[model samples]
Target chain A: MREDKKTPSVRKLRVRKSHIKTRLVLFLLLTAALMLTVIFAQQICPYDPNAQDTSISLQPPSLEHLAGTDRFGRDMFSRILVGLQTSVLSTLCLVVIITVAGTAAGILCGYYGGILDSVVMRISDVCLAFPGLVFALAIASLLGGGLHNAVFALAVISWPKYARIARSQTLSVKNTDYISAARLAGGNSIQIIIRHVLPNSIGPILVTSMLDIGTMLMELAGLSFLGLGAQPPTAELGNMMSGGRSMLQTYPWVIIGPGIAIFAAVVIFNLLGDTFRDYLDPRNSRRN
Target chain B: MEPILTADNLTKIFDEKGKEKFTAVDHISFQLYPGETLGIVGESGSGKSTLAKMISRLTDITEGNLFLCGKEITRVKGKALRRAYEDIQMVFQSPAASFDPRRTLGDGIGESLRNHGVSKVNVQKEAVRLLKECGLSPEFADRYPHEVSGGQCQRAAIARALAIRPKILICDEATSALDVTVQQQIMELLGRMREEREIACIFICHNLGLVQSFCDRLLVMYEGKIVEEGTPDEVIKNPRSDYTKELIEAVL
Candidate 1:
C-alpha cells in the first residue's frame, strides 16, 4: 500500500515538472517569433508595400517580385509582410483594451454584487445580444474607417465576454476563506477585492484573453474585407486579399500569399492560447 | 469574570425560494468571558456554525444583537464596523478552501496586518511570529497553499487569524477536516493559546467528545435554536435536553 501511494506521487511529480517545462518552451518560442516578426518587418521585405509599378502589373511569380504583382502592380509578398504588422498591431490593441476594461468591470460587478452588478451585467447582455460582425460593422460605420476605429469597434464588442467571465470568477473568489480572513483583519472592501479576489481570478482571465486574440484577429480581417478596416495603401491582409480577388484566376498567388499569412498568424495564436489554457487552469494542472 | 464577547438573542433567517423562510439561527444567546472557551456543539443542520458566524460578524443578524467589548455590533457600520473586526477573528473548517491558492501563506497572514494600517516591517515580523507560534517554519510563508499539507494549511490559517491578537477567536469546525492525530494537536494548541493570551473563544463543532475536552462551557443547538447551555461537565454528566443527549450518544 505504501509503495503504491509512493509510486503515483513520484509519477505525478515528474509529470508536473515536464508540464512546466513544456509551457516555458512554448511561451518562449511564440513570444520570440512574434517579437522578431515585428522588429525585422521593414528590413526583411525587399519591396516597398505602397510603391506600385504599373509596367509589371499582373505579372506572375518571378525574381523581381517573388510572390508576383497584384492588379495594381504592388508586390504581394511585401504587402503581406506589412499586413502581418497591421493585423498583429490591431489584435494587440484589442486585447489590451479588453483585458483592462473587462477585468475592471468584472471585478467591480463580481465583488460588490448588488444594484451595480445588475446594471453592469444588463449592459453586457445587450452588447452580447448583437452578432459580433453586426456590432463591429455598426461601430466602425459610426466611428468611420481607420486602424484606431477598427480597434475601438473590436474592443467595444469584445469586452462583454471578459466581463462576464471575470464577474463569475470574482463572485466565487469573494466568498473564499481568504476574503473573510481579510475582512476580519479589518481590510475594507477595496483592500479585500484587490488583495484577495483579483489575484485568484486573474488566471482564468489571462487564459480567456489569450484565446480572444485569435478571434480578434479574424474579426479585424473580416472588417477590412468589407472596406470597414484599413484604408488603401495601408497594406492590411484583408485589403490585400480584396485587391487581389479581381484577378484571382489569372494570378492565384496574389490571394494565396496573403491567405497564408492570415492562416499562420491565426493558427499560432490559437495553439498558444490552447496551451495557456491548459497550463493556467488549476483543474487541468492538478490532474497532471 | 467580565465577558469579552456576548450574543443576546442572535438570530439569522434566510428567505428560501417560494413561501418558505429558513431560520438558520433562531434566537441563540451566549457569552464568552475572558480566558474562557465556549464550544457551540451540534450536528450539520443544527446551526452551531451559523451561531459562530454571527459572533464573528460573517453573517448579519436578522432580529437580534451582538456585543464585543460592550459595544453593540448589530447596528455598527462603516469605520465603526471595521474597527469592531480587529477584536474578532475566525478560523474556518477547510483551510485549503478558505484561502486563495494563488497567494503565499505569508502574504495571506501579512494582508490582515497590512489592512489595519500596520507598518510593513511590523506586519512581516508579526506574520513570522504567528507562523512560528502555529508550529510552522518561517520558510512556509513563501509557499503557496497547494505547496503545503492540509494540517499545515490549517495551521497557517490559524496563524492568519491570530495575527491581529484579537480578544475573541472563533473556530468554525476548525479541526474537523484534519486527521484524528492532527485534530488532537490543534485542540491542544487552542488550549495553549487560550491560556497564554487570555482570549475568549467560540469553538463550533459537531463532535461532542472533541468539545467536551476542549471547552469550559458547551451550548447544544437544535434546528437553529440553543436548546441547552451549561458547563461541559454539567451538560455532559447530566444532560437536560433530549436532543443534547441524543447528539452526545450519536457521536460517542
Candidate 2:
C-alpha cells in the first residue's frame, strides 16, 4: 500500500478555519439581531403595544405610525417587535425542552433494546398518531391557556419525532464493534451508552433538533393564533396577526409586519439547520 | 501440553419466528494450549466465528462449559467476567468499524486499561508502546480511526487488545478485510507476537491455506460441528473428513 508523504495539515487547517468562521459569523449575526430587537423595542415605538389612541386609530403607514396603527390605535410596529420577543422566547423554551427530553428518551430506548425500548417506542408512536396542533390544543386546554402552558403543550407534542429518530440511530450505533469493544474492556452499560453510543448517534440527533426548532416556532405561532397561547397585551406575533385580520384592508402593516418577522425567522433557522446537516455529514466534507 | 482454554458441548441456537430453529454452533468442543495457534477453518455460517466468540466470552455459550486458564468462565459475570476479558482479548474483522470513530485511537486503547484500573500515566505510555509494537507510529495515538488506513487501524486494534496483556488473543477474521500484501504482514506480525509473548491464539478464518502456513494445529468446522482436527500437515496432507478435504482442495 502506498502511503502519502505530505501531511494534510495545511488542507485540514484551511477546512477547519473556514468552517468555524462561517458558522461563527452566522451565529453572531442571528444572536445580535435577536438581542437588538429586544433592546430597542421600547425606544423605537411611538406608542406602547397596548396604548390606545382613538384619534389615530386605523391610520395607515405615516410619520406618526411607522407600521400604521391597528383598529385599537396601537402601533403595529411596536406590537410586532414585542411579539417577536414572546414568540422567540416561547419557541426557544419549547425547542430546548422537546429536544433534550426527546433525545434522552430516544437514546435510552435505542441503547437498551428490550422491554423499556418497546414501551417507550409504543408511547412515542401513540403520541405521534395525533395531529400535532390538535394534540397541543387538547393539552393546552387541559392545562389552561398561557405562555408556559402552550410551550409545555408544544414540547409534549414535538418530542416523539426526536425520540424515534434518536432511538433508531442509537440502535444502529449500539451494535457497532466499538460498543462491543467497550463492553469487553469492562465498560458498563451506561458507560457504553454515554461514551460509545451517544457520541456516534449525536450527529443525526443534532440535525433533527435544529430542524425541529423551526417547526416548534411555527407551532407556537399557530397556538397563539387560536388564542391558546400568549394572552392579549403580551405582544405575540400570532396574536398581533389575529387582532389585525379585521382591519387588514385599511391598515395592511398590522398583518404584514408580524408575517414578515415569522417568515424571516423560519427561513433563517432552516438555512442554519441545513448548514449544520451538511457540515456534520462526513461524506459531504470528504467530497470537498 | 495442557490446554489453557477448553470448551465442551458448545452450542448456539437462533429462534427465528415461523422458521425452523437454527443451530449455529452444535456441540462443538475445542482446547487451546499455551503458545499455540489453533486455526478454526470453515465456510460462512459454519459457526467458527461463533465458537471463537464463545471461547473469548464475547458471546455467551448457549449450552456448554468454557474453562479459561482452568477456571469455568461460563457462569462468570460482572467483575469476574471483566477479569477474564483482561486475560483474553479479541480483534475483529473490520478494523474500520471496530474503533469508535469519534474518539482518538489512543482513547480506544486506553479504555481497556482504564476499565481494569491501570494507572492513567501508564496507560498512555503503554498505549503508545503497544501502537509502536504493532507497527503503528506513535502519532497514530492522536488521530481518529478515519484518519488512518485500514491496515494501520487493524494494527491499532491489535495493539488495543494487547494493551491488557491478554494470554489468549482471538483473531476473528482479523486479516480478511486487508489487501493481500497487508494480510501477509498482519499474519507475520501476529505469528511473531504470539511467539514473543507466548500467547495462545484462536485464529478463525474461511481461508484454509492461509492458516495452514501460520497455525500449528487446525480445526475444520462444517455445519456448526468440528468435522476434523489434527496438525496442519495431517489436515492438509492426509485429511480424513470429506468437508476438510473439500475445503483444502478448493483453497489449494
Candidate 3:
C-alpha cells in the first residue's frame, strides 16, 4: 500500500510552542521561589517573629530589622515571611480540596445524568446563587476564628465553580462518539469516566483551581484582616496587615512588608492560572 | 435461514419537559441475515441513526425488543450487556470525533480487541496488522485521528470495528461526512471487508445512490417510520410509496 500517500499524523504535531510550556515554567519558577521561602521561612528571617523587641520598636527599615519593628515590638520582616507561609499553605489546602470535590461531583452528575445530576446540580446552583465571598465569610465566622475554618469556608464556597466547570466539560465530552465507542468496548461507567472524562476535563479544572488558589489566598488574608483568621501571635500576611494598619503612619515598614508579599504571591498564582487557561483551552490555540 | 439480527417494534420518543413531545423512531422492525448489507435511507432526522443506536444499545430503546442470534436483548445489563456490545459495533459519521484526541489511533483500534481478552502486549501488534488489512500502514496506527485524512480515519474506524470480531456492524452515516471521492473509497473498503467476513451490516445513510449500489436491501424511512422496504432493484423498478418514489426521483 502507499504508506507515503500522506505525511502521516505524527508530523503534524510539530515541535512548536504548543500550549503552556514556557509560561507554565515561568509561573512555576515564581511559585517555587515563594513556596521555598515559605518552607524555610524561619531560616530566611533572623528575628523571633513573636518576641517583644522594644529596643527596635518603630525602627524604619535597616540592616538589623529589614522591615523594622511593629507596635508590639515584633519583627515585621519575620512576621510577613511567616504570614506568607500560612496564607499560601492554607490556600493550597483549600484549592486542593475544592478541585477534588468539585471535579468528582461534576463527573458523577455528568456521567450518570438524570436524577443524580438534578440533585447535585441543584446543590451546585444553590451554592452558586449567593455571593461566594459573603457565603465564605458567613461560614468562616460561624465555624469560629482559625486558619482551618477559613480554609474550610473557602473550600465550601469554591467547590461549586469547579463542579460547574467539570460538569460542563464532561457534558461536552460524554456526547462525543469516542465515549460511546468506549462504552461499546465494554467499559463500565467508572472506567469511561476515569480513562476518558477525567483526562479531558482536568485541564480546565486545573486552570480554574490555580486561579482560585490566588482568590482563596486573598480571601484568607481578608478574613485574617477582619479578625476571623490567624489568631494573634501567629504570623500571617493579613494578620500582619491588620496589626500594622494602626501603625501605618509611624511603622510604614510593617504594612509595606506584608503588602508586597501578598501582592507578589497573588500575582504569580493568578498569572499561572491565566496562562494555563489560555494554553489548555483548545479555543484559545491557533494551531487547532 | 434464520436472520443474524432482528429488531421488533423498536421506538424512541423524546419527551421534552413532559410537554413538547417528538418521536424520533417509531415501531420499526427489520431482519438482517448473516453477511447481508441492509441500508436504511432517508433525509436528516429520518430516524436512521436513532435506529442504529437503538440496535447497538448506545441509545435506550423506549419500546420493543431486539434479537441478536435468536436471543432477546430488550434490556441488556450486567455481563450480558458487555456480551451484547461485542456482538455488535457502531461506526459514527464523525471519524475524528469517534477516537480520543489524546491517544494514538492504535489505542482506539485496540480497545475492543483488548476488551475481548487480547493481551496488552500483542494488542498493539494486532492493531497494526488490522490497520494493514484496512489498507493503512502500520505507522498510521501510531498517529492521532486528526493527523490522517478523512478516508484514512474512516479506515482506522473500520479497523476498530473489525477488532471486536462483531457478528453485526452498524455504520451510522459513516461515509456521509467525507468527501465524495473519500466516500467512494471507504465504501469500496467496506465492501471488501464484508466479502471476507460473515458479518451482517446495517448501513444508515441519506445517500440513495450508495444504498442502491452497495446494499442488498433498502428500507426507506420518513418521519420516524419506514415507508417502504425491498431489494434495491424492487424499490427502484417499482416504487410502492410516494416517499420512496420521491426519494428515487430526487436521486434521478
Candidate 4:
C-alpha cells in the first residue's frame, strides 16, 4: 500500500485528542452537576422547598434564604434546584421513548421503502402538521393536567420529527454499495437493518435528538407555566415561575430564581448539543 | 459439462410512478463454466451492471431464471437465499464503498465467514491468511478502508470474495476504478486465483482492451441485450455486429 501518498496523516489524530479533552470535561462537568442537584436535593438544601412560612413571605436574595422566599414563603433556591431535577428526569424518559419509536419507524420505512414506507410517512406527516406545544397542550388538557400526561403528550407530538429525520437519512444510505455488500454477505434483513442501516443513519438522528432535548425542556416548562405540568405546592420550576408571576414586582426574586433555572437548562443542553454535532461532523473530523 | 452459472431470458424493467417506465435489461441469456472468464463489455446504460446485479440477486429479475451451482435461485428467500451466496459472490467497482466504514478491513473480510458458522477466534486468523494470499501484508487487515489506497482496498475486497470459496465470482467493473498499473496487478491476481480454484468468473467492464487480453469469452451488450458473443480474440479480430465493430474501433 502507498502509505505516503494515500494514508490519512496521523497528525490529525493528535489534534483530535485535545479537541475531545475539553469537550469531554465540559459535557461531563455540566451533566454531573445537574445530576447532583437532583440526587442530593434534600441533603444540600437547608430548608424544605415546599414548607412555606407566611411570616417571612416577602423576602429577597439573602444568606438566610437564598433566592428569597415567595409570597407563600417557599424557598425559591431549593424549589428551582429540585425543579431542575424533575425536568431532567422527565425529559430523559421522553427522549428514550421518542428515540425508540422514531428510530424504529425511520429504519423500517427507510430500509423497506414501498407501501409500508408510504403508510408510516403519511402518519408521521399528519402528526407533524400539529404545532408541537399546541398539540401537547391539547393532549395534556384532554388527558387532564399532570406532569406525566404532559410528558406523554409531548412525546406523542415529538417523535415524528425524529422519525422524519431518521427516515430521510436511512433512505439516503439504503442503496449505497456498502449496504449492498452487507446484503450479499448473507446478512439477513433485520441484521442488516440494525447493524448497517442504523449505524450509518445515526449521525443525523443524534444531532436532531440533541436539539430536541432543548426544545422539549422549553415545551415542558411552558406546559407547567400554563398550570398543566407538576401541580402546585410541589415546587416545580415552571409552576414556581407561574406562582411568582402575579407578584412579579412585589417579589421579583421568586420569579427570577426559577426563571434562571429554566434558562440555564435550555442553554446548557443546546450548547452541549451544538458541540456534539460539531464533534461528530465528518468534515470537521477530517480537518482534525 | 454442466454450466456453473446460467441466466435464461433475464430482464429488468424500471417503473416510474406506475406510468412512465422503461426496460433496463432486455431478455439476455448466458452460461459460465467452471474455470471460464466471461467478459461483458458494454457502454454505460447498456445494462451490464443491472445484469450482474440480477445474477448476484442484488436486484430482483423482472423475468428470467438463474441457476447457480445447480440450484434455482430466482425466488429463494431467508436462509436458502443467504446460502445462495455460498455459490455466487460479487465484487463491486468502488471497493471503498463496498466495506462498512465503521469496521476494520479485517472485520469486513471475515464477515461472510462469520455468517457461515466460522468461530469468532478462527475468523481473525482466516482473515489475515486471506489478506496475505491476495498479496497484502496481514497487518493491512487492521487498517480501515480510508487508510488504504484504492488498489489496496480492491485487493482486500478480492480477498473477502475469495474467502467464501464461491464457485462463481462476479466482478462488475472491479478494476475500472484503479490506475493502469494497479488494474493490471488486480487482473493478474484474479487470473492466479481462477487457475488455483477453477472458479467461474463473470467480468463486467467497459474496457475492451483489458477484456480482450484477460477474458476467454466475450459477450457484447447493447441496451441490455447480448448483441454478439464469441471468443474475445474472434470478437476483436472479426467483429460481426455493427455495435461490436464500433466498440472495438473506438478502443483501437
lDDT of 1 by residue, A1-288 (tens): 898879987788669757866875887697669758855777788889889789888788898888888877888778888888988887888898899899999999988888999999999898899998899899999999988898898888889989988999998887777777777878778877777788778888898898888888888988898888999889898878887788678779988898888888888888888887766655545541
Pairs clashing within candidate 1:
A177-B98, A178-B98
lDDT of 2 by residue, A1-288 (tens): 123544575577568757855984796588568658766777765577888878878778888777788877888778877788788777877788887899899998887678998998889888889988999899999998788899988887888988988888987887788887887788877788888888877788788878776778888998888888888878888888887877578767878888998988777777777777766666545532
Off by over 4 Å in 2: A1-32, A35-65, A69-75, A281-283, B118-121
How well is each residue in B76-107 modelled by candidate 1, as lDDT tens digits?
87788888878888999998887777778988
lDDT of 1 at A140: 97
Every candidate's DockQ is 0.66, 0.59, 0.59, 0.68
DockQ for candidate 3, C-alpha atoms: 0.59
Error of 4 at B179 (Å): 0.3
| Model 3, span A1-288: residue lDDT tens | 466744553444332334366777888898889889989998888888889967667888888778888877787788888888889988888888998999999989988899999998888888888898898889988999999888888788778888889999999999999999898888878778988889887887887788887888898899999988889889999988998898788767888889999999999989988877766666545544
Q: What TM value does model 2 have?
A: 0.89
Model 4 achieves a DockQ score of 0.68
TM-scores for chain A over all candidates: 0.90, 0.85, 0.89, 0.89
Give the C-alpha lDDT of model 3.
Answer: 0.87
**Candidate 4 stretches greater than 4 Å from native:** A1-24
Candidate 4 lDDT, tens digit per residue, B165-216?
Answer: 9988999999999999999999999999999999889999998999888889
For model 3, name the residue pairs that clash: A83-A236
Better of 2 and 4 by lDDT: 4
Fnat of candidates, each listed: 0.83, 0.74, 0.70, 0.70
lDDT of 2 by residue, B1-252 (tens): 778998888888877689899899999888889988999999998998888778767777779888887899997887888888878899999998999988899999999888778898998898999988999888999999988999999999999888888899999999999999999999988988898899999999999889988898898999999889999889888989889889988986
